[model samples]
Target: MEHKILGVIGGMGPKATSVFFDKVVEKTEAHKDQDHIDMVILNHATIPDRTSVILEKNEKMFITAIKKDIELLEAAKVDHIAIPCNTSHYFYEDLQKMTDIDIIHMVDETVKKIVETYGANCKVGIMATSGTISSGIYDKSATKFNIDLSVPNQTLQDQIMKIIYNDIKNDLTADTNEIEAIIHDFIFKQNCSCVILACTEFSCIKLSEEIQSYCIDAMDVLVERSIELSGKQLKSLQQNKSNAAII
Candidate 1:
């Protein structure tokens, strides 16, 4: 069987990109080294910050950088691409137009999972970069899925931004206490059924047991979809190895 090459357009923040790639490797149902899916990762760390571009309304540099990455992946002959950064999906449509390669929609996939797991009435709280929230990418997906979405207020949003940029992005320890309090507010105050870690940087934070119960990491969803699209079985499916083989 011919397998598709999975392309990762990453390094929006270097650590998040690393985590996504690690999940891909860890979640593949591979018995040997060769059983793993074929992948090409373009860790283009030099790409300008998505939040800065979106907020400033000057997207030329960002667009140019992303287009170059896509071109590099296209030249590599990757069949599909996945971008791990939630904020960057604001340009997903435009990016798709620049290449023939298929790009997986992370926000759409994440929203679908919410609907599938909790039904249309589910209220999901979003933890993402200000750019992602302002871009309304998740909002659009929530509307499409007919699910209610909640976001932090301006004050809380600023704190979240600091955790993402000042802490996680800069290799400092994340403030788990603050994150937990936010999650608590989302669940108890906002009446959210679950929270989506829409920012890749949030993936770097260790979720406390209470928060872990209700939080969904968007990066994990993207990793799963990437594996599926690449023609590889999920590691979880290996529990039924014989059945998986038959399929």
Candidate 2:
């Protein structure tokens, strides 16, 4: 059987792109290499910083670069496209209009999963770039689903930006304390039922198991959707099926 092709528009930060690719491969349930999904990956590492473009209110350069990627994917005959960058979803509608093929909405899929897993009344905390937060991408989706949101204040948000850009993006070690403290506040103080690791950069780090329970990684959601949409079974799902049969 021919598996559907998945097009990836990546390199918002190179590490995040690598992790996303690894997750797709690791999570896919394939008996052999032939069973794996075919992919077209464009590591557009030089694409401008998404947060800066949104804050600067000048998106022409970012749009132009990504548009080319879309056209290329369309020509490649990809069944669907997955952009692992959460901040780039700020320009989602325009990006979608640029191609007939579907570009998986990472933000929307994350929010929907949160509601389905935790229920609509749950308060969600967002940990993302200033651009994604300021653009109201999560807020818009949460409101539509009738879920409450708890975002980091200016100071906390600044710390997150430093970790994302100053540290992770630069290949320096990050101080994971900032991430822990923010998650603590959201879950304990703000009474958020769950916190979203909304930025792809967060996926590149290791969070403690305790901290992870109260958080959802948006990248993981995107990965699951990408694999399924590309006509592959998730490894986790395949395992569950095997266990059920044994029972």
Candidate 3:
């Protein structure tokens, strides 16, 4: 098979980008270095915080900067582009328009994965930043897949944001016990079939064994698709799931 190069538009949060890259390498079924997919990663960490831009309604600044990244990836002649940040996907359509190369739609693919795994009627819960929830990107994708979507209430949403920014982004340890409590509420109270960890920052935190069955990391979904799209084989499911194992 002719393998293709994967282009990563990263550094939305430096740690999460590193985690995504590490997951890709860990989850690819490769025995030697030569079997791995070739990659081009542009760590555009200086790009404006996605949540802030969306909340402040300053789309132009983010768009202007990301457009350049797209052009650079195109010039690099990559077969596909993957943006690991969930909130940045709020500009998915516009960014897709800027280049001929396909930019993997993390939100859309995540919704599709839910439908495929749990069935279309499964009630889904999203744990993402306020901007992602407000932008309605996951909601729109869920609607298309006929999957019902739910989100944390305001108080919990604020907690999620703080965990992403104040904790993980600041290089502090995430309170996984608190995070798991929220996940339990989604499952037992809100009746969510499975929760989608839609933020890349969450990808950097290892999930507990109890909630792993009830959650799907959107970043993991993106990593899997990126490998497949690059024409590389996926590691066995049991092995691939280890990358997101116990916090």
Candidate 4:
């Protein structure tokens, strides 16, 4: 059987990309290696932190790094590609013009699913990087999909920033008490139906089964997409089976 290959442009946070791949495998309904999608992961950790450079006004370096990886994936001739970072999507138009390959939009895809599964006008909390918030990626996507977005107050946004950058990325969760409390306030007290873990770094969290009851982690949503788009489904190949030996 011919295998369909997927090219993943990852390593925006380095580890988030790795975890996303693991999720593709875990979510695949396939029962064997042959049933999985073939993929090439360009774990280009050298790429600068996308959110930092965007929020900090440093651009050329990240643009160059991303272009190099996109070129590599194009050379590999993979069927589809996706970057798991939401904030980095501000650069999607630039990348799209640069490559012929399909670039799946995490922001767009996640919003479509959220509305279809959640509702058309439900209130949602966003827990993305400052850059993601600043760029208005989620807000735009949500508006396009007709979901109302409510953001935490500035003080709470700061607390979220610390938990994502300082706590998760820096391995300083023990000292993130202030941020954890803020998360609780945004979800429980605010009556947010769902909170989008808009930053990929938040994927490293161990969501309290309590939080899991309401919020959907962003990375997990991307992985589910990777699996669905992988072209590995037996149902996808059913038409080709008509040529099989007569039974």
Candidate 5:
């Protein structure tokens, strides 16, 4: 089978890009080597802070960075493309207009899956970047399917952003257990069916074996959906290639 390469416009911070790739590999149902989708990881760290740009309403630097990445991915002739950064998706329309490669909407697919697996009105606690919150990306996703959306209070929101920017983004694993416990509290106390990891960095702190058991990782679904839509076969993922090859 011909290998289909999926392009990643990443490096809003390298950690999240790495996590996204790991999940993409893990989510692949490949049983053989050739069945996995090849990837082009363009770690364009030159893109400025999306949260600040969005909040500050300064997109020139961010837009330029995205266009550079889009142009790079298109020139690489990748079969499809996905942006790992959640906040950067705010410029999806702008980049999509410039690129010929299909741009997969990662959050939209996660929301659709949530609605299908849970229910239309499922209560979900969102953990995301400030930009993502301000942009109402998750809110938009929830509203599309009539799902209930809740975010951390202003204080907690600021704390979450710090954890993401300071701890995860900087590659320093700050103890987010206390913060995550509060999130866990919301899941049970507030009667949320699950929590949504709206920020890519939040995925890192979610490494707790306990938290992993509770929160649903929207990133996994996004990657799996990208693979499916990218026309990648199910056999060539770096791991389990032999087992999934038959598929």
Candidate 6:
């Protein structure tokens, strides 16, 4: 079988990109280094802040940076690509026009997973950067899936922003208690069945067990789709168990 080369357009915040790549490795069905999928990772840490570009209406630099990354990936001959950052997906359509290579839609895949796991019309909470929430990228997919979407109030949203930018991005320790409280409010007060960690930065933090059961990481969805589209199978349930034993 011809294995497809997967391209990762990453380093929106840097750490999140590393986490996403780690997840892909952990989830792939590989016994040897050669069994792993071929990957090209462009850790373009120079890409400007996506949230700022949207809010300030200064998108030229952002678009140019992303387009350059895509061009580099295309030159590398990657079969498909995935971007870990959700906020950057605001320009997803435009990016697609710049390249023929398939860029997997992280938001769409997360929304589809929510509907598949929770059912249509289920209430879902979004925790992301201000730009992602404002752009309504996930909202569009939610509408398509008939899923009701809710977001943190402005005050809480600010807290989330701080966690992503100040904490995770800066390599500081994330406050798990704060994240847990936010999830609790979404579930109990807002009546959401599940919360989507719509920001790639969230992948850097470890969620509490209780919250883990009710939360979905958008980055994980992207990783799974990246593997599938690249013609690789995710590690089977039984294989995962056996691998754990070998550790």
**Model number with the top TM-score:** 3
What is the C-alpha lDDT profile of model 1 across 1-247, one tens digit per residue?
4679999999888889998988788788889999898889999899999999999997788999888889889899999999999999999888989988889999999999999999997899999999999999999999999999997899999999998888889875788988888888899998999999999888777777678788888998999999999988888745544553554
RMSD to the true structure for each prediction, in A, is 4.2, 3.7, 1.9, 7.1, 4.0, 1.7
Question: On lDDT, who's better, 4 or 6?
Answer: 6
Regarding TM-score, does 2 or 6 come out ahead? 6
Output the TM-score of candidate 1.
0.93
Which sections of candidate 4 miss by over 4 Å?
1-3, 172-180, 233-247
In model 1, which residue pairs have backbone atoms overlapping below 3 Å? none
TM-score of 3: 0.96
Per-residue lDDT of model 2, residues 198-236, tens digit only: 999999988787998898999999999999998888898
RMSD of 2: 3.7
Give the Cα lDDT of each candidate.
Answer: 0.89, 0.90, 0.91, 0.76, 0.78, 0.89
Candidates 1 and 4: which is better by TM-score?
A: 1
Error of 1 at 210 (Å): 3.2
Q: Report the Cα lDDT for residue 137, model 4.
A: 83
Model 3 score (lDDT): 0.91
Flag clash pairs in model 2: none
3 versus 5: better lDDT goes to: 3
Q: Largest lDDT belongs to which candidate?
A: 3
Show the colliding residue pairs in model 3: none
TM-score of each: 0.93, 0.94, 0.96, 0.87, 0.88, 0.95
